[model samples]
Target: MSAPAAALDWAQGVWDWAAANWYYPDEPGRGIRPRLIEHIRLSYASIAIGLLLAVPLGLACVRWKPLYPPLLTGVNVLYAVPSIALFFLLLPYTGFSDWTAIVPLAVYTLVILLPNVVDGLHQVPDHVRQAAVAMGFGPLRRLVRVETPVALPVIIAGLRVASVATISMVSVASLVGLGGLGRLILSDGFRRQFDAPIVVGVVLVVLLAFATDALLVLAQRLLTPWARRDRPRTGSVRRRRAAATAAADAPALASTAVAPPGKG
Candidate 1:
C-alpha cells in the first residue's frame, strides 16, 4: 500500500477502535476513557509529590550550600535507575496499585526539579539579593517575595519538562498490572498484535504531554509577568528581565554591598 493509503487506513482504524473501546456503557471501567483518566491521575500525582519533595530539598540546598551536592547526587541516582526495575522493586510493597507507578515517576521528577529550583534561586543576581536584604527583607520573606518570582520561569521550565516526562513514564505502569493508556499499547495492542490500540495509546500520550507542557507555559507567564516581553518570544524574556533587574538595581545594590560594617 502507498504511504497515503496506509495513513488513511490507520486513521480510519483508530476512529473505529475509539468508537468501540474508548467508552462502553456496558463495561464502565474497562475502556480507553478510564485508562486515559488513570494515566492523567498518575501523571498529576507524580508531579505533585515531586514538587512537594523537590522544592523543599532544593530550597534547603540553596539555603545551605553544603546540602546541594549530596541531595542532587541522590536524586540523580534515582533518575539513573531503570523505571521498570523501580516498578518491580516497588511491586512487592506497593502491589499493583497506583502508588507503584506514582512513586517511581515522582522520584524521576526530582532529577529535573531539584536542580532547576536550586539554580533558579541561585540565578538571582547577588546585587538584587543585596538590595532585598538591605531593604529589611528577611531570608524567608525575600525568597517568597523577590527570589521566587525571579526564579519562577526557570522553575516552570523544569516543571514543563518534568510533567511531560511523568506523563510518558505513566505508560510504563501498565507493566505492573495498573491501568493507563499503556494497556492499550501493551495488553490490547502488542499482545494481540493490533495496530489500532497501540496507535491510539501513542497518540494520546503525546497529546497529553503537549497539553500538560502548554499549561505549564501559561502558568509561567502568569506567575512571572515581569519576565514577559512587550511581545512574546521564546528563551529571551527571562534572561533579559533577570539582567535588566540586576542592572537596574546595580547602583542601589552597590552601596548596600560596600557599606562599612556596623554602620547604620
Candidate 2:
C-alpha cells in the first residue's frame, strides 16, 4: 500500500476501535461517564484547594509588597520542579493514593495562581482605591468590594491557566496509579499499543481545557461589565476615524479656498 493509504487505513481502524469502546452504559461505573467524572473531580478539587491556599498568600503578598519578590521566587522554583519528580517526592510520604496526585496538582495550581492574585489586586486603579477610602471603607471592605471585583479579570485569567495545567498534569498521575482519564492513556493505550484510548484521552483533555477556559472568560465578562461597556465597537472606531479625517481636512480645505487659487 502507498504511505497515504496505509495511514488512512490505520486511522479508520482507530476510529472504529474508539466507536466500539468509547462507552459502557451497561457496565456499572466502568466507562466514559465514570472516567470523565473522575477527571473533572480531580481537576476541580486541585484547583479549589490551590485557591484556598494561594488566594490568602497572594493577598498577604499584596499587603506586604516586599514579601512578593521572595514569595514569587519560591513558587517559581516549585513550579520549575518537574511534575513527575514532585510526584515521586511526595509518593513516599503520601503513598500511591489520590493525595499524592492531588498535592502536586494543587501546588502547581497555586504556583500559577498566586502571582495572578497579587498582580490583579495591585492592578486596581489608585483612584478607585482612593474613592473607596474616601467613602469610609475599611481596608478589608475595600479589598473585598473594590479591589477584588476590579481584579477579578486578571485573577480568573490565572485560574483559567491553572485549571488547564491541572487537567494536563493529572494525566501524568496515571503512572503512579492515581490517574483519572489518564489511566486510559497510560495504562490501557501504551500497554496495549492502542491508538483509540490514547486519542480519546487526549481529545477529552483538550475539550475540557477549552470548556474550562471559556467558562472562566464568561465569568470574567459577567463580573466586569464596566470593561465591556468601555470597549469601542469596530463600527464606532471606523466612524470616529472618518470624523477625525473630515475635521482635519476642514481647516485645510477652508485655507485653500480663501488662499486665492493663485497657484492655479
Candidate 3:
C-alpha cells in the first residue's frame, strides 16, 4: 500500500478503537472516563503537594540570594534525570505504589515551580519592598501582603508549566502498572499493536495539557485583577469609538450648517 493509504488506514483503525472504548454502558473499567479521572487525580495531587513544598523554600531563596545558585543547580540536575529511571529508583523505597510515581512527579514540579517563584519574588520592585518596610510591615507580613500578590502572575505561569508537565508524566507512570489513560495506550495500542488506543491516548494527553494550562490562565486572571486593568474594557472601547464617530461627523455638520439667506 502507498504510505498515505497506510497512514489513513492506521488513523481509521485508531478512530474505531476510540469509538469502542471511549464510552461505557456497563463496563466502567474499559471506559475513557475512569482513565481520565485517574489521570487528573494523580497529576493534580502531585502538583498540589509540590506547590506546598516549594513555595516557602522559594520565598526563602529570594531572601537568601547565596543559596540560589546551589539550590538551582540541584533541582536542575533532578529535572534532567529521566522519568522512568526515577520511577524505578524510587520503586524499591516506595514499593510499587502510587508514591513512586507521585514523588518523582512532585519533585519535577518543584524544579519548575521553585525557580519561577523565587524569580517572581525577586522581580518585585525594590521601591515596593522599601515602601512596605517604611510602612512598618514586618518581613513575613510584607512577603504575604505586598510581595506574594505582586508575584502571583509569575508564580501562576510556573504553575501552568508544572501542571502540564505533571499531566504528561502521570500518563507515562502507567508503564509501571499504575492506572491512567497511559495504561490504555501502552497496553492496548503499543503492547498489542492496536492503533486506536494509541492515537486516543496521545490526543487526550495534548488536550489535557492545553485544558489544564487554560484553567491556570483563567485562575491567574481572576486572582490578579490588577493585571487585567491594563486591558481595554468593552465600555471604554465603545466610548472611544463613539467619540471618534462624533468627531468625524462634526466637520460634515459644520459644512452643512444653514444661515439666514442674505442676512450678511
Candidate 4:
C-alpha cells in the first residue's frame, strides 16, 4: 500500500483503541486531550513569562555593555545544564509541581532568545539612530519607533526559536507527571505498546512545530510586508538607474574641467 494508506491504517487502529479505552472508568486515565491541553498551557505560560523577562533584559544588556558578559554567561550555563538534571535538581525543592517544569523551561528560553535580541538591536544602523536623534526623538522614543520596528523581524525570529525550544522541553516535563504527550510515551512505552505512543508524540510535535512556523510566517508578512515582498526587483531597478545616471555624469564633468589639455 501507499504511505497515506499505511498512515490511515495505523491511525484507524489508534483511533479504535482510543475510542474503546478513553475515559472508560476502568481505564480512568486514558483521555489524552486534557493532558495535551495542560502541557500546551504550561508551555505557553512559560514562554510568555520568559519573553516578558528576556526582551527587556536583552534590551538592557545591549544598552549596558557591562551586564552582557555575566548575564549571558549565567543563561548559557543554565542552558548547558542537562534538562533531566535540572528537572531532578528542582524536584527536591519544588517537588515536581508545575513550577518545577515552568521555571527551568522559562530559563531555557533566555539562552535561546537573548543573544538574538541583542544582535537585532545592534543591527540597527548608526545613520538611523542619528536621523532619529536629529528629528528630536529621545532615547525611549527612538527605541520604540525606530529601533524596535527595525529589529522586530530578528526579535520575532528569536521568539520563534524560543517557542520551539519551550515545546520540546515541556515534553521532557511530562516525565515529572505534568501530563503531556511525553506522558503518553512514557506510559505506553512501559507497557510495551511501542507504536501508539511514539506515533502520537511524533505527530503532536510535528504538527505543533508546523503550526508555530506558519503563524510566524503570517506574522512576518503582516508586520514587515517589506521584508517578504520582492523589493529589489522593483525598487532596485529605479535605484540602479539613478546610480547609472550619476556614474555617467561623473566622466563628463571631469573631462570638461581638463582645460582642453593646452589652455593652461
Candidate 5:
C-alpha cells in the first residue's frame, strides 16, 4: 500500500479501537483530551514555579556579578543533561511522581530563563536608571517602578520562550507513565497506528505554542507601548513644540531690535 493508504488504514484501526476502548472513567487514561490537559497543566505549572524561582535569582545574580558565570554554568550543565538520564536520576527519589516531572522541567527553565531575564534587566538604558536614582528613588523603588516596567517586554519574551520549551519537554514526562499526549503517541505508534498519534501530537503542540506566543505578543503591546510609541514620531512632536516656542519669542525679538538700542 502507498504511505497515505497505509496511514489511513492505521488511523481507521486506531479509531475503531478508540471508539470501543476509549472511555475509561475510573482510570481517565483513554481519552486524548484529559491526557493533553495533564500535559498542559504540567508544563504551565513547571514554567510558573520556575519563573518564581528564576526572576528573583536573576535579580540577585545581577547584584553579584562575580557569581553569575558559575551559577549560569551550573544551570546550563543541568539543562544539558539528557531528559532520559535526568528522569532516571530522579526516579530513585521521586519515583515517577508528579514531582519528578515538575522538578526536571523547572530546572530546565532556569537555563533558558535566567540569562534572558538578566540580559533584559541590563538592557534598560543606564541614563533611565540614573535619572530614577537622581530623582531620589531608592533601589527597590527604581527596580519596581522604572527598571522592571521598562524591562517587562524582554522579560516576558524570555518567559514565552521558556514556556514553549517547557511544553515540549513535558512530553518526556510520559516516559515515566505520567499521563500526557506523549502517552498517546507512544502507545499508538507502537501499535502501528501512526497517523492518529502524529496528528494529535502535532496539532496540540502547534496550538499550544501559537496560543502562548500570541498572549505574549498581546502582553508586550500592553506593557511596552513606549517601546512601540517612543520613535521618530515623537521627534515630530518635539520639533512642533520647539517651533511654537520660537514663534512666541519672535515678536519680542523683532520689537526689541526695532525699539532703538538701550534708551528705554
Candidate 6:
C-alpha cells in the first residue's frame, strides 16, 4: 500500500480505539470520560480557590501599597519553583491525594492572579473613587459598586489566562497519579505504544481549555456589559484623532492659505 493509504489505516484504527474506549462505566472511573471529568474538576477548583484567595489579598495590597511589591516577590518565588517539586514538597502533608495537586495549582493560580487583581483595582480612576466618596459610599460599597465594576474587565481577562494555564498544567498532575487526560498520554499510551490515546488526550485537553475560556468570556460579557461598549473601535478612534489633528491645524492652514508665499 502507498504511504497515504497506510496513514489512513492508522488513523482509522485510532478512531476505532477512541470509539471503543471513550467511556467505561464497568470500570467505575478509569475511562476517558472519567479522566476528562477529573481534569475539569482539578482545573476549575484550583482557579476558584485562587480567585477567592487572590481577591482579598489584592484588596489588602491595594489598601497598603507597600505590601504589593513584597507580596509579588514572594508569589514569584512560588511561581519559579517547579510544579513537580511543589507536588513532592506537599506530598507529605497532602500525600497521594487531589489536594496535593490542588494546593500547588491554586498557589500557581494565585501567582498569576495577584498582579492582575492589583492592576485591575488600580485601573479604577481616582476621580471615580472621589465621586464615590462624595456620595458617601463606604469603602466596601465603593469597591463592590464602583471599583469592582471597573476592574471586572481586567480581572476577567486574568481569569481567562489563568484558566487556560491551569488546564494545561493539570496534565502535569498525571505525574503524581491525577493526570486526568494526561493519564492516557503518559500511562497507557506511552506504555502500550498506542497512538490514539495520546492524540485524543491532547485534542481533548485543548478542547477543554477552549471551552473554559469561552465560558469565562461569556461570564465577563454578562458581568461587565459596559466594558464592550466603552471600548473604542480602532477605526472610530483613528477617525477622531484625524479630525482633532485637522481641527488643531486648521488655523495654521488658514493663515498659510491667506499669506503670500515666501521667496526661497
Report the Cα RMSD per candidate.
10.8, 14.2, 15.9, 15.2, 17.1, 13.5
Q: List where candidate 3 sits over 4 angstroms from the true fold.
A: 1-12, 23-27, 229-264
Error of 1 at 246 (Å): 23
Best by TM-score: 1
User: Weakest 10 consecutive residues, lDDT, candidate 5?
Assistant: 255-264
Residue pairs with backbone overlap in model 6: 174-179
Tens digit of lDDT per residue, candidate 6, span 18-113? Answer: 888888777968678899999998989999999999999998898889999999999888888888888888888987888988898898889878
Deviation in Å, model 1, residue 134 alpha carbon: 0.3
Clashes of 5: 0
Candidate 3 lDDT at 140 equals: 93
TM-scores for the candidates: 0.85, 0.80, 0.81, 0.78, 0.77, 0.84
Best-first order by TM-score: 1, 6, 3, 2, 4, 5
Local distance difference test, each candidate:
0.80, 0.77, 0.78, 0.71, 0.72, 0.81
User: How many residue pairs of model 4 clash at the backbone?
Assistant: 0
| Global local distance difference test of model 3 | 0.78
Candidate 3 global TM-score: 0.81
Off by over 4 Å in 6: 2-4, 230-264
> Arrange candidates by lDDT, highest first: which order?
6, 1, 3, 2, 5, 4
Residue pairs that clash (backbone atoms under 3 angstroms), model 5? none
The residue-by-residue lDDT of candidate 2 on 179-203, one tens digit each, is 7888889877999987778888888
Which of the two, 2 or 5, has more lDDT? 2
